[model samples]
Target: MISMHKIFRRLIVFSILLQLLIACPLQAFAESEEAIFAGGCFWCLEHDLEKLDGVVSAESGYSGGDLINPTYQDHSGHQEVVKVVFDSDIISYKDLLKQYWVNIDPFDNNGQFCDRGYSYKPVIFTSNQEQKRDAKESQETISVGLNIPLEQLKVDIVESKVFWLAENYHQDFAVKNPLKYNFYRSSCGRDNRLKKVWGEYKY
Candidate 1:
């Protein structure tokens, strides 16, 4: 039979182990971060960013405008954006910024590809100073690499505003309606434009 002292010691060890296990996951969760970007067609942007390994989720949303409870039909000032949750341990924000650049037509201030309007315009909404700094630096890098002037790189890097989640039907539309999503993407000339703007370098 086990002694009382042995049982007490075992319980102590077990409690410490449980605490450690709980703390580890909490620590890892703390590393999770959010990033917001608008590159036209929230469905496309949401689908594109979610393909990255470290990204936990990419949800379609509307942001960068004063509109409250914005929806798909009438989001006048708001731009269609993707809110990306990623594990910083696996992928840094700088890496994400690089990926964003190649996927967009930086010269198009009016909108991206076939989607023309204020809602379809490209933007990088930085939530903090670090993100803002990284975004501006990435913009500069893209300008130099593409041989375009800073003013010509139309992708705006600005402060992030309230990101209202889009309607449930809009979220994960690509995964839900693969055929329709593929047809729309192809017809919209998104990939073709990306290829022309970025050559063979895109994510």
Candidate 2:
């Protein structure tokens, strides 16, 4: 009879454990995700964002162009962009925006680094209206809080209609050809100029 009591207690405990497990909401766990930017060559930002702890993937692409299907040659009018997939749990959107700001020359309205023209210029293609608001608000904060003056040109925070992946050859161009990537980056002078403008800024 005493042994029966122990069995009852064990059964009750097991039932409670099973109930507890069932009670756990099935909502998907927070996972890392994507955030994109087209500040310049995808290679430039790709390398920087990939260094973060939770970033899963970074691919360069084309966005905000009028062309229906833009290719490298046809991408003439399109901006060079990067699509970064990361673990959202590990890195917040605000942090990603901060990382974006650190890379581009907010003061220069033209293409970032050494690259010139609208195609290489800075633009934050937002995933949603909330992100749009956040991007604008962030820029305003950076202007006042960050030491580097805004180039006085309007920062384009456009809604992305579609993000077309770049050709296979362009994917991870930096990783595939380290020498070429390094040479392109250096010649563009993106790093030196960015450091000069933002290295001292608090943002």
Candidate 3:
């Protein structure tokens, strides 16, 4: 089981950010805000983030690859990413980063959930110096809460780039193909493994 101290710390971090958002919900995104992450199944992240109130849209795609416009079959080397678009008015990028931090094991620096490959590695793509700083600082927060060394986590914080959305079928795979999505999620050992790693913060 994960340590109670850590869960308490993360909860503190999450609550602090949410309080900031709730205080300033109308501070909308200055532009077409974007945040991309590669954490195992895009379908899972897509489904989860889409449920948030301020999230305008979320698309599954491939990033940090040599090839552009990659497909699921063609994503042999690229990490599957979820491109999230949100309105700043309803929430803040800092809060989004907080949620992202809670969702995966950043320490592995490899694949997330059941996947074990560079293609499934977790990363954050930021748009500016502010985001760069925020992502880095947030990584530190996660590292402290999880008792993971900074260098061991090895999370990448790169500049944001264009994202070519995955095929339509992958857009809403979880909803369109619930059974298959559930099977993929289960087979990946994501929930089970996460439960083992994170029982108290099993949200």
Candidate 3 stretches greater than 4 Å from native: 1-32, 201-203
Model 1 residue 3 lDDT score:
100
| lDDT tens per residue, model 3, 40-90 | 788988887877878888899988877876888887657889999988777
Q: What TM-score does candidate 3 reach?
A: 0.78
Clashing pairs in 2: 32-86, 32-87, 32-88, 33-86, 114-188
Clashing pairs in 1: none
**Model 3 local distance difference test score:** 0.80
TM, every model: 0.87, 0.79, 0.78
Query: Per TM-score, what order, best first?
Result: 1, 2, 3
Q: Write the per-residue lDDT of candidate 1 for residues 1-203, one digit (tens) a residue.
A: 99999999999999998998887866464679999999999999999899998998899999999989988887879999999999999899999998888888888979899999999999999999999999999988887887778999998889999999999999899999999999999999999999998896533
lDDT of each: 0.91, 0.80, 0.80
Expressed as tens digits, the lDDT of each residue in 1-203 for candidate 2 is 56988999999999998887788633233475567688878888888887887677788889888887898787866888998887777777777888888888776658776777888888888888777888887888787886446556345888875788989988878889999989998988888888887777775
lDDT of 2: 0.80
RMSD in angstroms, all models? Answer: 3.5, 6.4, 16.1
TM-score-superior candidate, 1 or 3: 1
- Pick by TM-score: 2 or 3, better one: 2
